[model samples]
Target: MQFTIIKYEIIVVSFVALLIFLLIGIAYLTLLERKFMASIQRRRGPNVVGIFGLLQPIADGVKLIVKETILPSHSNTLVYVLAPIFTFFCSLVLWLVLPFGQGHALYDFPLGLLYILAISSLSIYGIIFSGWSSNSKYAFLGGLRSAAQMISYELSMGLVLLCVILVSGSFHLGSIIESQVYSFHSVTLFPIWIIFIVCILAETNRAPFDLPEAEAELVAGYNVEYSSLAFALFFLGEYANILFMSALSTILFLGGYLPIIELIPLPGILWFTVKCLLHALIFIWVRATFPRFRYDQLMKLGWKYLLPLSLSFLLVESSILIIINPY
Candidate 1:
C-alpha cells in the first residue's frame, strides 16, 4: 500500500511538471511563429516585451487573465464557458501516451497510437459545442465547417496511420519507433509522409487549410464570441494541438528520439525534441508561404485527392506486409 501510494504521488507530480512544460512550449510556439513570420515579411516583430520578445507570451497571458471576460447574454452560459475548457483539456491529455524516448514516456500504453487518434477525434466536439452555444450564425457555420473538414481529413489520416501500423506491425508508439531503426519511413514512404503532413495541417486548423476559421468568411470562426481567458484557452489549445501533431509526425517519420548520427552522444529525448521542433518550424513556414485554400477547394483536396491516395497506399502496404510475413 505504501509503495502504491508513492507511485500515485509520483505520477501526480510528473503530470504537473509535464503540464507546465507543455504550457511553456505552447506559449513559445506562438512567439516563434510571430518572429518567424516577421522575418519572412521583413517586418519588426514583438521586440518590446523582453529581449527579442521573449516575454511576449507572458504579457499576453497576464493581459488575458486580467481583462474582463465578456459573456454573450443570449449564449448558453454553461456550455459557452465549458467549451474552451474542454478543448484545452483534450489538447493537454494527448501528451499522456507520447513517448519522449525509450523508457521515457509518462504511460507507455500498448495502444498509444489509437489513444491519440481517439482523443484527436474528441477535440472536434469542443468546437461544435462552442459554435452552437454561441447563438450566432457565423460561429455556427464555422463550427459546421470544422466538423466536416476534420471528419473528412481524419479519414485520410486514419488510413495513413493504418499504413504505418501495417509496416510496423504494432500499434504501440515505441514499437513503431523501434521499427524505424534501420531506415526511416520518411525515405521509404515519402509519398505517404507528404500526405500525412497535409492531413495534419488541416487537422490542426493551420493556414491554407484553415477554412473553418477563415477571417474573411467566418470572422473568427467558432470562437468568435470568446474573449479574455476564454479566447486564450482556444489559442493555447490550437498551438498545443499543433505541437502535438508535430511530435506525432516526428515519431511517425523522422525516427522519434533517434539520433541522426550513430556516433553522436546526444540524449534521445533531445534528438526527439529537435526533430519535433523542425516539424513545428515547418508548420510556421508553410503558414508564411501558402495562401489559404478556398473552402470548396480544401474539401475537394481532402476527399477527392488525399483520401484516394491514402487508401491506395494502405492497400499496397497491407499486401506487402502479408507477403513478407505469411504464416
Candidate 2:
C-alpha cells in the first residue's frame, strides 16, 4: 500500500512537471515564431519587453489576463466559455503518452499512437462548438471549414501512422523510438520518415494546409468571437498542438533524442528539443514561403494525394518485409 501511494505520488508529480514544461514551451514558441517570421519579413520582432524581447510572451500573457472578456449577446455562454478550455486540454493530454526520449515519457501505453490520433481528432469538436456557439456567421463558416479540413486530412494522417506502426511493429511510441536506434550502417529507413513529416504538417494545420484559419476568408476562423484571455487560450492551444505534432514526428521518424551520428554525448532531451525546433522552423518557413491552399485543393491533396500515397507505401512496405522475413 505504501509503495502504491509512492507510485501515485510520482505519477502526479510527473504530470504536473509535464504540464509546466508544455506551458513554458508554448509561451516561448510564440516568441520564437514571431521572431523567425519578423526576420523573414525584414522587420524587428518583439524587442521591447526585455533584452531581445525575451519577456514579450510574459507581457502578452499579462495583457490578455487584464483585458475584459466580451461575451456575445446571443452566444451560448456555456459552450463559448468551455470551447477554448476543451481545445487546450485536448492538446495537452496527448503529451501524457508522448515519449521525449527513450524511457523519458510521462506514461507509456500499448496504443499510444492511436491515443494521440484520437485526441487530435477530438480537438476539432472544440473548434466547431466554439464557432457554432458564438452565434456569428463568420464563426460558423470558420467552424465548418475547420471541421472539414481536419476530417479530410485525418484520414491520410492515420494511413501514414499505420506505416510507422508497420515499420516499428508496435503502436507504443517508446517501442517505435527503440526500433529507430541503430548502428552506423543500420540507419532508420527513409519512406516512413517522409510520410511522418507530411502527416505532422497536415495534422497541425500548418501552411499549405491551413485552410480553416485563412485570415482573409475566415477572419481568424473558429475563435473569431474570442477576445482577451479567452483568445489567448486558443492561441496557446494551437501553438502547443503544433509543437506536439512536431515532437511526435521527431520521435516516430527522425529518431527522438537519438543523435543523428550518435558520437555526440548530449542528453537525449537536448537532441529531442533540437529536432523539434528544426521541425517547427520548417513549419514557419513554409508559412512564410508558400501561399495558403484553397479549400478544395486542400481537400483534394489530402484525400487524393496523401491518402493514396500513404496507403500504397504501407502496402509496399508490408510486401517487402514479408518477402525478406518469411516465417
For model 2, residues 16-102, the per-residue Cα lDDT tens digits are 988888888988988998999999999999999999999998998999989999999999999999999999999888888877777
lDDT of 1 at 98: 92
lDDT of 1: 0.93
lDDT at residue 180 of model 1 (Cα atoms): 96
- What clash pairs does model 1 have? none
Over 4 Å off, model 2:
183-192
Q: What is the C-alpha lDDT of each candidate?
A: 0.93, 0.83
Question: Which parts of model 1 have CA positions greater than 4 angstroms off?
Answer: none
Candidate 1 residue 186 C-alpha distance from true site, Å? 0.9
- Model 1, 289-319: lDDT tens digits are 9999988899899989999999999988888
| Highest TM-score against the true fold, candidate | 1
